[model samples]
Target: MSNEDVDSRRRRFLTITTGLGVVGTGFAVAPFALSMAPSERAKAIGAPVEVDISKIKPGAMRTEEWRGKPVWILNRTPDMLKTLPQMDKRLVDPKSEVDTQQPAYATNETRSIKPEILVLVGLCTHLNCSPLAKLKRGGSEGMEGDWLGGFFCPCHGSKFDLAGRVFKNVPAPTNMVVPPHTYLSDSRILIGVDKNKKSKKSKAKA
Candidate 1:
Protein backbone atom coordinates (compact mmCIF):
# COMPACT_ATOMS: atom_id res chain seq x y z
CA MET A 1 0.00 0.00 0.00
CA SER A 2 1.17 3.59 -0.56
CA ASN A 3 2.51 5.50 2.52
CA GLU A 4 -0.42 7.95 2.52
CA ASP A 5 -2.95 5.12 2.27
CA VAL A 6 -1.17 3.17 5.04
CA ASP A 7 -1.17 6.24 7.30
CA SER A 8 -4.88 6.78 6.71
CA ARG A 9 -5.64 3.12 7.49
CA ARG A 10 -3.58 3.28 10.70
CA ARG A 11 -5.44 6.47 11.76
CA ARG A 12 -8.83 4.79 11.15
CA PHE A 13 -7.78 1.75 13.22
CA LEU A 14 -6.60 4.01 16.07
CA THR A 15 -9.89 5.96 16.10
CA ILE A 16 -11.96 2.77 16.19
CA THR A 17 -9.81 1.29 18.99
CA THR A 18 -10.01 4.52 21.06
CA GLY A 19 -13.79 4.63 20.61
CA LEU A 20 -14.13 1.05 21.84
CA GLY A 21 -11.88 1.80 24.82
CA VAL A 22 -14.06 4.75 25.87
CA VAL A 23 -17.22 2.69 25.44
CA GLY A 24 -15.71 -0.16 27.48
CA THR A 25 -14.76 2.19 30.33
CA GLY A 26 -18.24 3.70 30.36
CA PHE A 27 -19.86 0.23 30.60
CA ALA A 28 -17.49 -0.82 33.42
CA VAL A 29 -18.09 2.37 35.48
CA ALA A 30 -21.85 2.51 34.98
CA PRO A 31 -22.60 -0.65 36.94
CA PHE A 32 -20.24 0.33 39.75
CA ALA A 33 -21.73 3.81 40.09
CA LEU A 34 -25.23 2.39 40.09
CA SER A 35 -24.27 -0.18 42.76
CA MET A 36 -22.79 2.52 44.96
CA ALA A 37 -26.11 4.37 44.99
CA PRO A 38 -28.72 3.05 47.40
CA SER A 39 -31.41 0.68 46.20
CA GLU A 40 -35.16 1.27 46.56
CA ARG A 41 -35.45 -1.40 49.23
CA ALA A 42 -32.64 0.25 51.20
CA LYS A 43 -34.28 3.66 51.01
CA ALA A 44 -37.56 2.15 52.16
CA ILE A 45 -35.81 0.49 55.07
CA GLY A 46 -34.33 3.79 56.27
CA ALA A 47 -37.50 5.78 55.74
CA PRO A 48 -39.93 6.65 58.54
CA VAL A 49 -42.17 3.83 59.75
CA GLU A 50 -45.79 4.45 60.65
CA VAL A 51 -47.62 2.37 63.24
CA ASP A 52 -51.30 1.98 64.03
CA ILE A 53 -51.81 2.12 67.78
CA SER A 54 -55.60 1.76 67.91
CA LYS A 55 -55.71 -2.00 68.31
CA ILE A 56 -52.87 -2.24 70.83
CA LYS A 57 -55.37 -2.36 73.71
CA PRO A 58 -54.57 -0.92 77.11
CA GLY A 59 -51.93 -2.97 78.96
CA ALA A 60 -50.89 -4.53 75.63
CA MET A 61 -47.72 -3.88 73.65
CA ARG A 62 -46.97 -3.79 69.96
CA THR A 63 -43.64 -4.21 68.23
CA GLU A 64 -42.56 -2.67 64.93
CA GLU A 65 -39.33 -2.40 62.96
CA TRP A 66 -37.61 0.86 61.98
CA ARG A 67 -34.13 1.06 60.41
CA GLY A 68 -33.73 -2.63 61.19
CA LYS A 69 -34.25 -2.07 64.94
CA PRO A 70 -37.26 -3.11 66.96
CA VAL A 71 -39.53 -0.26 68.13
CA TRP A 72 -41.99 -1.00 70.89
CA ILE A 73 -45.32 0.69 71.59
CA LEU A 74 -47.03 0.01 74.87
CA ASN A 75 -50.56 1.14 75.72
CA ARG A 76 -50.22 1.67 79.44
CA THR A 77 -53.08 1.05 81.77
CA PRO A 78 -53.71 3.48 84.64
CA ASP A 79 -51.95 1.01 86.92
CA MET A 80 -48.92 0.93 84.65
CA LEU A 81 -48.73 4.71 84.75
CA LYS A 82 -48.77 4.56 88.54
CA THR A 83 -45.84 2.12 88.58
CA LEU A 84 -43.49 4.68 86.97
CA PRO A 85 -43.24 7.13 89.88
CA GLN A 86 -43.16 4.32 92.42
CA MET A 87 -39.93 2.97 90.86
CA ASP A 88 -38.29 6.37 90.33
CA LYS A 89 -36.00 5.84 93.32
CA ARG A 90 -34.67 2.63 91.80
CA LEU A 91 -34.14 3.98 88.26
CA VAL A 92 -30.81 5.15 86.81
CA ASP A 93 -32.41 7.94 84.78
CA PRO A 94 -36.01 8.14 85.92
CA LYS A 95 -36.60 11.51 84.28
CA SER A 96 -34.91 10.56 80.99
CA GLU A 97 -32.19 13.12 81.71
CA VAL A 98 -29.82 11.69 79.07
CA ASP A 99 -30.68 13.96 76.13
CA THR A 100 -29.35 11.53 73.56
CA GLN A 101 -31.63 8.76 74.78
CA GLN A 102 -34.82 10.51 73.62
CA PRO A 103 -36.18 13.64 71.97
CA ALA A 104 -36.85 16.82 73.92
CA TYR A 105 -40.58 16.25 73.89
CA ALA A 106 -40.14 12.77 75.30
CA THR A 107 -37.89 13.81 78.19
CA ASN A 108 -40.58 13.31 80.79
CA GLU A 109 -41.59 10.94 83.53
CA THR A 110 -43.10 8.50 81.03
CA ARG A 111 -40.56 9.27 78.27
CA SER A 112 -43.47 9.59 75.87
CA ILE A 113 -45.70 12.20 74.24
CA LYS A 114 -48.78 10.63 75.76
CA PRO A 115 -48.63 9.54 79.36
CA GLU A 116 -50.50 6.34 78.62
CA ILE A 117 -48.55 5.29 75.55
CA LEU A 118 -44.86 4.47 75.82
CA VAL A 119 -42.52 4.11 72.86
CA LEU A 120 -38.95 2.89 72.92
CA VAL A 121 -36.29 1.16 70.92
CA GLY A 122 -36.20 -2.40 72.23
CA LEU A 123 -32.41 -2.95 72.15
CA CYS A 124 -30.55 -3.05 75.45
CA THR A 125 -28.27 -0.03 75.86
CA HIS A 126 -25.51 -2.12 77.48
CA LEU A 127 -25.09 -4.52 74.64
CA ASN A 128 -27.54 -4.47 71.62
CA CYS A 129 -29.37 -7.56 72.87
CA SER A 130 -33.18 -7.61 72.71
CA PRO A 131 -34.66 -7.80 76.18
CA LEU A 132 -37.52 -10.03 77.17
CA ALA A 133 -40.71 -8.09 77.92
CA LYS A 134 -41.70 -8.99 81.44
CA LEU A 135 -44.81 -6.82 81.41
CA LYS A 136 -46.56 -8.56 84.25
CA ARG A 137 -45.75 -7.56 87.84
CA GLY A 138 -43.83 -9.76 90.29
CA GLY A 139 -41.70 -12.81 89.42
CA SER A 140 -43.82 -14.14 86.61
CA GLU A 141 -41.16 -13.52 83.95
CA GLY A 142 -38.16 -14.83 85.90
CA MET A 143 -37.78 -11.54 87.74
CA GLU A 144 -37.25 -10.86 91.44
CA GLY A 145 -40.18 -10.64 93.80
CA ASP A 146 -40.19 -6.86 93.63
CA TRP A 147 -39.99 -6.67 89.86
CA LEU A 148 -42.71 -4.26 88.65
CA GLY A 149 -43.11 -5.42 85.06
CA GLY A 150 -40.65 -4.09 82.50
CA PHE A 151 -37.88 -5.59 80.40
CA PHE A 152 -35.13 -8.01 81.42
CA CYS A 153 -32.05 -8.59 79.31
CA PRO A 154 -30.95 -12.17 79.71
CA CYS A 155 -27.62 -11.42 78.01
CA HIS A 156 -26.21 -9.49 80.99
CA GLY A 157 -29.00 -9.25 83.58
CA SER A 158 -30.04 -5.67 82.88
CA LYS A 159 -33.39 -4.50 84.20
CA PHE A 160 -35.56 -1.70 82.77
CA ASP A 161 -38.82 -0.35 84.07
CA LEU A 162 -42.02 -0.27 82.00
CA ALA A 163 -41.09 3.21 80.88
CA GLY A 164 -37.71 1.94 79.60
CA ARG A 165 -35.78 3.58 82.43
CA VAL A 166 -32.61 1.67 83.26
CA PHE A 167 -32.67 0.36 86.79
CA LYS A 168 -29.96 1.40 89.23
CA ASN A 169 -26.94 -0.91 89.26
CA VAL A 170 -27.72 -2.42 85.83
CA PRO A 171 -25.36 -3.11 82.97
CA ALA A 172 -27.09 -0.49 80.85
CA PRO A 173 -25.58 2.89 81.64
CA THR A 174 -28.62 4.87 80.45
CA ASN A 175 -32.27 4.54 79.58
CA MET A 176 -33.23 2.68 76.41
CA VAL A 177 -33.43 4.95 73.37
CA VAL A 178 -36.78 6.46 72.47
CA PRO A 179 -36.65 7.10 68.73
CA PRO A 180 -37.98 10.40 67.34
CA HIS A 181 -41.68 10.02 66.70
CA THR A 182 -45.01 11.84 66.29
CA TYR A 183 -48.62 10.95 66.59
CA LEU A 184 -50.33 11.51 63.22
CA SER A 185 -53.70 10.96 64.86
CA ASP A 186 -55.13 9.36 67.94
CA SER A 187 -54.70 5.97 66.28
CA ARG A 188 -51.56 6.44 64.15
CA ILE A 189 -47.97 7.23 65.01
CA LEU A 190 -45.09 8.02 62.68
CA ILE A 191 -41.60 6.98 63.88
CA GLY A 192 -38.20 8.35 62.85
CA VAL A 193 -39.41 11.95 62.60
CA ASP A 194 -39.81 14.55 65.31
CA LYS A 195 -43.31 15.77 66.08
CA ASN A 196 -42.52 19.43 65.88
CA LYS A 197 -40.55 19.03 62.69
CA LYS A 198 -43.33 17.09 61.07
CA SER A 199 -45.77 19.80 61.96
CA LYS A 200 -43.49 22.41 60.41
CA LYS A 201 -43.21 20.37 57.24
CA SER A 202 -46.96 20.05 57.06
CA LYS A 203 -47.31 23.80 57.34
CA ALA A 204 -44.69 24.35 54.63
CA LYS A 205 -46.46 21.97 52.29
CA ALA A 206 -49.73 23.77 52.83
Candidate 2:
Protein backbone atom coordinates (compact mmCIF):
# COMPACT_ATOMS: atom_id res chain seq x y z
CA MET A 1 0.00 0.00 0.00
CA SER A 2 1.17 3.55 -0.66
CA ASN A 3 2.30 5.68 2.35
CA GLU A 4 -0.41 8.17 1.48
CA ASP A 5 -3.10 5.46 1.59
CA VAL A 6 -1.82 4.21 4.97
CA ASP A 7 -1.84 7.77 6.38
CA SER A 8 -5.37 8.35 5.08
CA ARG A 9 -6.64 5.15 6.77
CA ARG A 10 -4.92 6.14 10.05
CA ARG A 11 -6.55 9.58 9.93
CA ARG A 12 -9.99 8.04 9.27
CA PHE A 13 -9.50 5.63 12.21
CA LEU A 14 -8.52 8.52 14.53
CA THR A 15 -11.57 10.56 13.48
CA ILE A 16 -13.97 7.70 14.09
CA THR A 17 -12.40 6.91 17.46
CA THR A 18 -12.61 10.56 18.55
CA GLY A 19 -16.27 10.79 17.53
CA LEU A 20 -17.14 7.62 19.45
CA GLY A 21 -15.32 8.92 22.54
CA VAL A 22 -17.25 12.18 22.38
CA VAL A 23 -20.58 10.34 22.11
CA GLY A 24 -19.67 8.10 25.05
CA THR A 25 -18.65 11.07 27.22
CA GLY A 26 -21.98 12.81 26.50
CA PHE A 27 -23.90 9.69 27.47
CA ALA A 28 -21.97 9.39 30.72
CA VAL A 29 -22.41 13.08 31.69
CA ALA A 30 -26.12 13.26 30.78
CA PRO A 31 -27.26 11.06 33.68
CA PHE A 32 -25.13 12.98 36.16
CA ALA A 33 -26.67 16.24 35.00
CA LEU A 34 -30.15 14.80 35.33
CA SER A 35 -29.41 13.50 38.83
CA MET A 36 -28.18 16.94 39.87
CA ALA A 37 -31.55 18.47 38.96
CA PRO A 38 -34.18 18.67 41.66
CA SER A 39 -36.62 15.78 41.89
CA GLU A 40 -40.40 16.18 41.82
CA ARG A 41 -40.62 15.28 45.51
CA ALA A 42 -38.00 17.87 46.40
CA LYS A 43 -39.83 20.56 44.47
CA ALA A 44 -43.12 19.60 46.10
CA ILE A 45 -41.54 19.85 49.50
CA GLY A 46 -40.15 23.39 49.22
CA ALA A 47 -41.53 25.12 46.15
CA PRO A 48 -44.28 27.73 46.24
CA VAL A 49 -47.73 26.43 45.32
CA GLU A 50 -50.28 28.35 43.33
CA VAL A 51 -53.87 27.70 44.32
CA ASP A 52 -57.03 28.26 42.30
CA ILE A 53 -59.66 29.75 44.61
CA SER A 54 -62.43 30.21 42.03
CA LYS A 55 -63.85 26.74 42.58
CA ILE A 56 -64.09 27.18 46.34
CA LYS A 57 -67.52 28.53 47.11
CA PRO A 58 -68.29 30.74 50.09
CA GLY A 59 -68.50 28.80 53.34
CA ALA A 60 -66.33 26.05 51.86
CA MET A 61 -62.65 25.23 52.17
CA ARG A 62 -59.92 23.57 50.13
CA THR A 63 -56.69 22.01 51.31
CA GLU A 64 -53.28 21.99 49.68
CA GLU A 65 -49.95 20.53 50.73
CA TRP A 66 -46.72 22.47 51.29
CA ARG A 67 -43.60 21.21 52.98
CA GLY A 68 -45.48 18.00 53.85
CA LYS A 69 -48.04 19.95 55.90
CA PRO A 70 -51.64 20.67 55.00
CA VAL A 71 -52.63 24.25 54.29
CA TRP A 72 -56.27 25.31 54.36
CA ILE A 73 -57.95 28.00 52.32
CA LEU A 74 -61.31 28.92 53.76
CA ASN A 75 -63.82 31.12 52.01
CA ARG A 76 -65.75 32.58 54.88
CA THR A 77 -69.32 33.61 54.39
CA PRO A 78 -70.66 36.86 55.87
CA ASP A 79 -72.18 34.94 58.71
CA MET A 80 -68.92 33.15 59.39
CA LEU A 81 -67.06 36.44 59.62
CA LYS A 82 -69.62 37.79 62.07
CA THR A 83 -68.81 34.93 64.38
CA LEU A 84 -65.15 35.92 64.68
CA PRO A 85 -65.69 38.91 66.92
CA GLN A 86 -68.15 37.07 69.11
CA MET A 87 -65.56 34.42 69.83
CA ASP A 88 -62.86 36.95 70.71
CA LYS A 89 -63.62 36.96 74.42
CA ARG A 90 -63.54 33.19 74.30
CA LEU A 91 -60.28 32.87 72.37
CA VAL A 92 -56.68 32.91 73.50
CA ASP A 93 -55.43 34.97 70.56
CA PRO A 94 -58.48 36.57 69.05
CA LYS A 95 -56.54 39.47 67.60
CA SER A 96 -53.64 37.28 66.49
CA GLU A 97 -51.29 38.99 68.94
CA VAL A 98 -48.68 36.29 68.54
CA ASP A 99 -46.58 37.84 65.82
CA THR A 100 -44.78 34.60 65.13
CA GLN A 101 -47.95 32.87 64.03
CA GLN A 102 -48.58 35.15 61.07
CA PRO A 103 -47.15 37.92 58.96
CA ALA A 104 -47.63 41.58 59.93
CA TYR A 105 -50.38 42.11 57.38
CA ALA A 106 -52.37 39.14 58.70
CA THR A 107 -52.32 40.21 62.35
CA ASN A 108 -55.85 41.49 62.21
CA GLU A 109 -59.29 40.45 63.35
CA THR A 110 -59.71 38.15 60.35
CA ARG A 111 -56.13 36.85 60.45
CA SER A 112 -55.96 37.09 56.68
CA ILE A 113 -55.03 39.36 53.81
CA LYS A 114 -58.71 39.53 52.85
CA PRO A 115 -61.54 39.49 55.33
CA GLU A 116 -63.46 36.79 53.48
CA ILE A 117 -60.66 34.47 52.51
CA LEU A 118 -58.53 32.87 55.22
CA VAL A 119 -55.35 30.86 54.71
CA LEU A 120 -53.92 28.84 57.57
CA VAL A 121 -51.59 25.98 58.24
CA GLY A 122 -53.82 23.10 59.37
CA LEU A 123 -51.51 21.77 62.06
CA CYS A 124 -52.36 22.40 65.70
CA THR A 125 -49.84 24.59 67.49
CA HIS A 126 -49.51 22.15 70.38
CA LEU A 127 -48.79 18.80 68.76
CA ASN A 128 -48.74 19.45 65.02
CA CYS A 129 -51.91 17.38 64.67
CA SER A 130 -54.15 18.25 61.76
CA PRO A 131 -57.44 19.74 62.86
CA LEU A 132 -60.87 18.82 61.53
CA ALA A 133 -62.89 21.54 59.88
CA LYS A 134 -65.89 22.11 62.06
CA LEU A 135 -67.09 24.93 59.89
CA LYS A 136 -70.74 24.83 60.85
CA ARG A 137 -72.15 26.70 63.77
CA GLY A 138 -74.31 25.68 66.76
CA GLY A 139 -72.79 22.31 67.54
CA SER A 140 -73.21 20.93 64.03
CA GLU A 141 -69.79 19.35 64.42
CA GLY A 142 -70.47 18.07 67.98
CA MET A 143 -69.41 21.08 70.04
CA GLU A 144 -71.45 23.25 72.38
CA GLY A 145 -74.73 24.65 71.09
CA ASP A 146 -73.19 28.10 70.64
CA TRP A 147 -70.23 26.83 68.69
CA LEU A 148 -69.22 29.16 65.89
CA GLY A 149 -67.54 27.89 62.73
CA GLY A 150 -64.01 26.65 63.46
CA PHE A 151 -61.70 23.66 63.63
CA PHE A 152 -61.67 20.82 66.14
CA CYS A 153 -58.58 18.78 66.87
CA PRO A 154 -59.75 15.36 67.99
CA CYS A 155 -56.23 14.28 68.86
CA HIS A 156 -56.12 16.47 71.98
CA GLY A 157 -59.47 18.27 71.88
CA SER A 158 -57.96 21.61 70.92
CA LYS A 159 -60.46 24.05 69.45
CA PHE A 160 -59.84 26.91 67.02
CA ASP A 161 -62.33 29.50 65.97
CA LEU A 162 -63.20 30.82 62.51
CA ALA A 163 -59.95 32.78 62.31
CA GLY A 164 -57.84 29.86 63.55
CA ARG A 165 -57.64 31.52 66.96
CA VAL A 166 -57.22 29.05 69.76
CA PHE A 167 -59.96 28.86 72.35
CA LYS A 168 -59.14 30.14 75.83
CA ASN A 169 -58.93 26.64 77.29
CA VAL A 170 -57.60 24.61 74.38
CA PRO A 171 -54.49 22.52 74.43
CA ALA A 172 -52.99 24.55 71.62
CA PRO A 173 -51.19 27.68 72.82
CA THR A 174 -51.44 29.94 69.80
CA ASN A 175 -53.56 30.51 66.74
CA MET A 176 -52.98 28.40 63.66
CA VAL A 177 -50.16 29.76 61.52
CA VAL A 178 -51.02 31.88 58.56
CA PRO A 179 -48.41 31.02 55.95
CA PRO A 180 -46.82 33.79 53.93
CA HIS A 181 -48.90 34.23 50.79
CA THR A 182 -49.97 36.74 48.19
CA TYR A 183 -52.83 37.09 45.76
CA LEU A 184 -51.79 36.60 42.16
CA SER A 185 -55.22 37.63 40.98
CA ASP A 186 -58.80 37.69 42.16
CA SER A 187 -58.95 33.93 41.84
CA ARG A 188 -55.39 32.83 42.35
CA ILE A 189 -53.02 32.82 45.32
CA LEU A 190 -49.35 31.95 45.62
CA ILE A 191 -48.32 30.35 48.88
CA GLY A 192 -44.85 30.47 50.46
CA VAL A 193 -44.30 34.14 49.59
CA ASP A 194 -45.02 37.28 51.55
CA LYS A 195 -47.55 39.78 50.28
CA ASN A 196 -46.12 43.06 49.06
CA LYS A 197 -46.31 45.29 52.09
CA LYS A 198 -45.08 48.23 50.06
CA SER A 199 -48.00 48.06 47.70
CA LYS A 200 -50.39 47.72 50.57
CA LYS A 201 -48.87 50.74 52.21
CA SER A 202 -49.03 52.75 49.01
CA LYS A 203 -52.67 51.88 48.58
CA ALA A 204 -53.35 52.84 52.14
CA LYS A 205 -51.57 56.13 51.62
CA ALA A 206 -53.62 56.83 48.52
Best by TM-score: 1
Q: How accurate locally is residue 195 in candidate 2, as Cα lDDT from 0 to 100?
A: 61
Off by over 4 Å in 2: 1-44, 197-206
Candidate RMSDs in Å, in order, are: 14.6, 14.4
Task: Say which candidate scores most in lDDT.
Answer: 1
Q: Which ten residues in a row have the lowest lDDT in candidate 2?
A: 24-33
Q: Ten residues in a row with the worst lDDT in model 1?
A: 24-33
Where is model 1 more than 4 Å wrong at Cα? 1-37, 197-206
State the displacement of the C-alpha of residue 129, model 1, in Å, after optimal TM-score superposition. 0.2
How many clashes show up per model? 0, 0
lDDT against the true structure, per candidate, is 0.82, 0.81
* Residue 33, candidate 2: C-alpha displacement in angstroms: 16
